[model samples]
Target: MARHNPSAPPESVISIIAPGMQIVGDCQTEGTLRVEGSVEGSIFAGKAVVVGEAGRVIGDITTQDAVISGRVAGNLVIGSRLELQSTSVVEGEVHARRIQVEEGTLLNGSVHIGETDGSTLTHEGQSDSEEQQLPIDAGSWHRPVVAAPKR
Candidate 1:
């Protein structure tokens, strides 16, 4: 039997929730999580979270960073940054250190940027990561093919 370390860093692990699959409970992970399906519960990611255009999430998301091109009907608590694609639809509050929303995106909630404690950053500097732009091509996410059952 192999031994597993619980406190190990997960920068190399990328978890994918493919299309046609539905998750009804909370998901917690230290690695990157890509959602191309539907999730009805909260998601807690330590690194980053990506929601493809075909995905739909009905619960909150807590992550260090996030990119959304789908529908999210819950609050977003992003520690680092949040990117909203043109096709993204978010219907809840958003709290992040930095945010970027492209044209055609639909957001129906309050946005709180800066810090979690409501204190604004008094510095006059911007990091390279903060100046990064959202990707121009996010509609090409893979969509799983589903075959009809034979009668």
Candidate 2:
């Protein structure tokens, strides 16, 4: 005999942007998102956002958490935490409560940690002195997710 539970919550969905695919507009999701291709617009995720080694996002990203291993050319407004792998490259500002950056990552913009006051982090330095910091933890590393093409 078997019993069924009707009140169980559904599993969290993970949206994938397959390789060779590209998105041109803003993307908003209530679950996790994994990007393996290219996105030209902003991404707003209710959960975590994962960017693979080949992923590229040209616009902003607003999420509760993020694990990035690709290239991001716009601002990042993460509410809770953010993790940047060794292969990640970022050219814009970042705002988060907690951040972890691996070695070998390249960042060409400013970073603000702590309270955001409901506003996205803005570049506070002059153009000639753009701040760049990579606080990589020597003992930790993050491996990017590699997606296999569907046959």
Candidate 3:
């Protein structure tokens, strides 16, 4: 569903994936995309992307801003900001200029924050995943989350 009502402005376009719906292919739009169901492919949005509590995504997402409160099983490259609500579960690389994460959010991969260019997070100068360490620069944080050794 598209928010193209008569009163809605032309530039304020919004696409909605209502509940019980499923999209199997990539979705590209210059406006906003509010997902309330499931998506099996990548989503590219110029403005913003919102995933509701029951929403789920199985592929990468590249957007200006994203608010995820459900499950995302792929990488996220957000240009401006990213917010993960308490119910969020993300399982891939996350790159964003800014991030807000709640207490119960489950993140199971690398996280890169305060990086304007989200493309250079290749663990530069690091060869082993087990030995990956967070940079000393506190303002810009990049760390790969790994399981701790058994006690």
RMSD of each: 12.9, 12.2, 9.6
Query: What are the per-model numbers of colliding residue pairs?
Result: 0, 0, 0
Candidate 2: give the clashing pairs.
none
Can you tell me which runs of candidate 1 are displaced by over 4 Å? 1-8, 118-151
Question: Which residues of candidate 3, in runs, are more than 4 Å off?
Answer: 5-11, 116-151
Candidate 3, residues 1-151, lDDT tens digits: the string is 9967787654379999999999998888877999999998778877888999999887777787899998887778787899999988777777788999998887877787876432432212111222333222222123433323334
lDDT of each: 0.73, 0.73, 0.74
Alpha-carbon deviation at 47 in model 3, angstroms = 0.4
Please, what are the lDDT tens digits per residue for candidate 1 over residues 1-151? Answer: 1123566567547778899989998887767889999988778877888999999887778787999999887777788899999999887678789999998887766787887664332111122233322222224223331222334
Q: Backbone clash tally for model 3?
A: 0
Highest-TM-score candidate: 3
In terms of lDDT, the poorest run of 10 residues in model 1 is 120-129
> What 10-residue stretch in candidate 3 is worst by lDDT?
121-130
Instruction: Give the per-residue Cα lDDT of candidate 3 at 13.
Output: 92
Give the winner by lDDT.
Answer: 3
How well is each residue in 87-118 modelled by candidate 2, as lDDT tens digits?
A: 98877678888999898887766788876755
Which candidate, 1 or 2, would have the higher lDDT against the true structure? 1
Whichever of 2 and 3 has more lDDT, that candidate is 3
